[model samples]
Target: MSAALQIGLVLFPKVTQLDFTGPLQVFSSVPGAKVHLIWKRIEPVASDSVLTLTPTTTFADCPQLDVICVPGGFGTDDMVNDAEMLDFLRQQAKAAKYVTSVCTGSLVLGAAGLLKGYRATTHWSAMDMLAPYGATPAKTRVCVDRNRITGGGVTAGIDFALTLVSILVDRPTAEMIQLRLEYNPVPPFNSGSPDTAPPEILALMQERIAPARQRRSEANGRAAARLGGDVAAG
Candidate 1:
């Protein structure tokens, strides 16, 4: 490889590790690629589960990235109003070749003012939140409107990463990487999406997530106000 492609994945408490790890594996597998786990400080960050990961770079020393990926989970509700974190994302996205997110990470991107006027997707539950950021919400597995690429839900990270690999390199390279990862999908249950899931299950999930959704709404309202967007719709 003639030149290295620098990739950064933002790390925070309660983030879904798979969202970052899935893409990290794909990018790191590419020759001449430098993948970074980034945070305010270089320390071990715990995920939503017991899984933990250490940041490879701090905000101060991190170099310009070719790709910036923001993953989401329970922490995102807190992060949307975190000034320092949002500023970090805004600054990095300004210089990155591609600004990306997986799941509810799009909300973080929105809070940073990066998703303004971009068509982006997020978890199905929070897809409508994009409106407050002046963004058009796209409800898809993976949505790529210009350089602002976003993925829907948690497991969609792998699919989004593979799609991104094709953009970063070529279709054949992405294909090879997928094959190496043995990325064939054969889910035992066909109820991954809200449309496919049984009504009872969907209702249960919504009930469980309602509190977090309320938190997210409040955070987005603040973020919208900060970014000079219409708070009413947020």
Candidate 2:
């Protein structure tokens, strides 16, 4: 029998619930897939929403995984310069078959020095922040550059997971999972992307998120500087 596919998702405080759960739902459908919610400690971690997730394994206890994924939210601000978290990701990426992230989770990967020279994507508001980490940012729902795969935003996690499923298993298997989940999305409005949203609405959103974006940008700058310093020190 083939070995079970081990997959781990890093769970951190204030993570966007959908960014983790959307991919979780899709990955759980794969036969013989062992999915783990991983954190520094095996405790309850709160999401940006009301949802609270419990880690199945602590970083110290988790087995080497075939896939390692990070899900993002405002919590990424805390992680971008976190030495322990970045070290853990660096350790895992050494042997993991794929290193992936959803939303601002790419920022965490970038902070870990993993996204250097790779093309990646993140939530639209944070797209410009990728370059400081030596990453080429793509404004797409899902992006794959070599072994790094990234999702654009919270809802994009489903698309990202399904895409990864196709690569890990097969297109037919991913299709079957999509069918079972009734994954067809037909929103009541065509305002999902900045390009599709009405100009005024887009402007309003940009204004509303400006403060958070600025804060994250500052964090990214510090993280990138730290990574550069580490490289120089080595």
Candidate 3:
């Protein structure tokens, strides 16, 4: 039998539930694909008191991955400042054939020093954080730069994962999965992107990101120190 394409999805406490679950659904729907939840510990982690997931393996116990996926949320804010977590992400991402992130998960990848000189995207509110890692921020919901792929905001994971399937497998396969999921989306609000959003809504999003930006700045600092300040060279 052919080996399954092993996909590792990184999970942590307070992660944005949709960022991981949406992609999980897309990837798991693929034939001969295996999804493994990887975390610092092999236990259930909660997502901001909303959902819980039991990790299939800790980082140390994980198998070699064909793909390494990172999801974003408040947990990512914490991960960006965590030395052990950053190191883990850095190593795993470096070794994986494909590295992907969802939402502000791009921030975590940036913090891990993986996006340097790459084209990437993240939650619109958090796109600025990619600068330090030498990435050009894209406004699109999904971006693929060489081996790295990134998705913007919460619901972008499904699109991102479907894109990966198209790349790694075939467009027909992706279309089949999309059809299976009834993937055509009709949003009630046309404000998914900043350009289409009402000024007040855009302002509110910017305002809400203030604290997160501050925390990301501090976390970037800490991550740099732990890496002996090599991030700037990227």
Candidate 4:
């Protein structure tokens, strides 16, 4: 029998829970799939929300994964500069069939020098940050460029995973999984995106997140410098 498809998602402090959990929920349904929550050590990690997550494996003990995913959140500020985490991702990407990210997780991949010369995407607010890592940022819900797949912002993970399912298994199987999960989304507000949100609301959010964005920018600058890329002050 064929070996089960091994999937690993990196877990870190202050992660945006939905970034990984949404995809986890979808991936769990894939037949013959084995999922692992990876970290530097096996312990409970706090997320941006009230939810806490535990790692199933440590970097040193993790088996080679078929798919390696990074989920983004405020935690990425630390991850971008984490030597061990970057090294682990680099090692895993060498053998992983797919290197992917959700939300700001793409920034972590970029820090590891994995997204160089790739087309990727991240949260709309941080789209401009990808260029320093040699990645061309695409504005979309889910962006797939060759083997690098990225999901934009928080809730886009579900869409990203469904798209990946279609590729990893088959469209029929993906459709079945969607149906089984009743994955129909009907958000009451048409304000999910900056393009759709009221101007004041968009401005307010941008203003509120500016500090985090600046921190992320500074962190990316350091990581990029380590990779011999141009460094820009935040």
Best by TM-score: 2
Q: Which residue runs does candidate 3 get wrong by more than 4 Å?
A: 224-228, 231-234
Local accuracy of candidate 4 as per-residue lDDT tens digits, 111-182: 988999999999998898888888999999999998999999999999999999999999998999899989
Candidate 1 global lDDT = 0.90
Off by over 4 Å in 2: none
Model 4: pairs clashing at backbone N, Cα or C within 3 Å: none
Better of 1 and 2 by TM-score: 2
lDDT for 99 in candidate 2 is 98
TM-score head-to-head 1 vs 4, winner: 4
C-alpha TM-scores of all predictions: 0.95, 0.98, 0.92, 0.96
Ordered from best to worst lDDT, the candidate numbers read 2, 4, 1, 3
Q: On residues 90-156, what C-alpha lDDT tens digit does candidate 2 reach at each position? A: 9999999999999999999999999999999999889998999999999999999988999998999
What is candidate 1's lDDT per residue for 1-234, written digit by digit as tens? 578999989999999988888888888888789998899898889899999889999988889998999999989988988888888887888889999999999999998889888999999989888898888998899999999899999889988998998998889999999999999999999789999999999999999989989988888888878787434446
Q: How many residue pairs clash per model?
A: 0, 0, 0, 0
Per-candidate Cα lDDT values, in order, are: 0.90, 0.94, 0.86, 0.93
Best by lDDT: 2
Report model 3's TM-score to 2 decimal places. 0.92
- Candidate 3 lDDT over 88-184, as tens digits, reads 8778876788989999888788777788789999987777667766689998989999999999999999999999999989999999999999999
The alpha-carbon deviation from the true structure for residue 171 of candidate 2, after best TM-score superposition, in angstroms, is: 0.6
In the predicted model 2, the residue pairs found to clash are: none
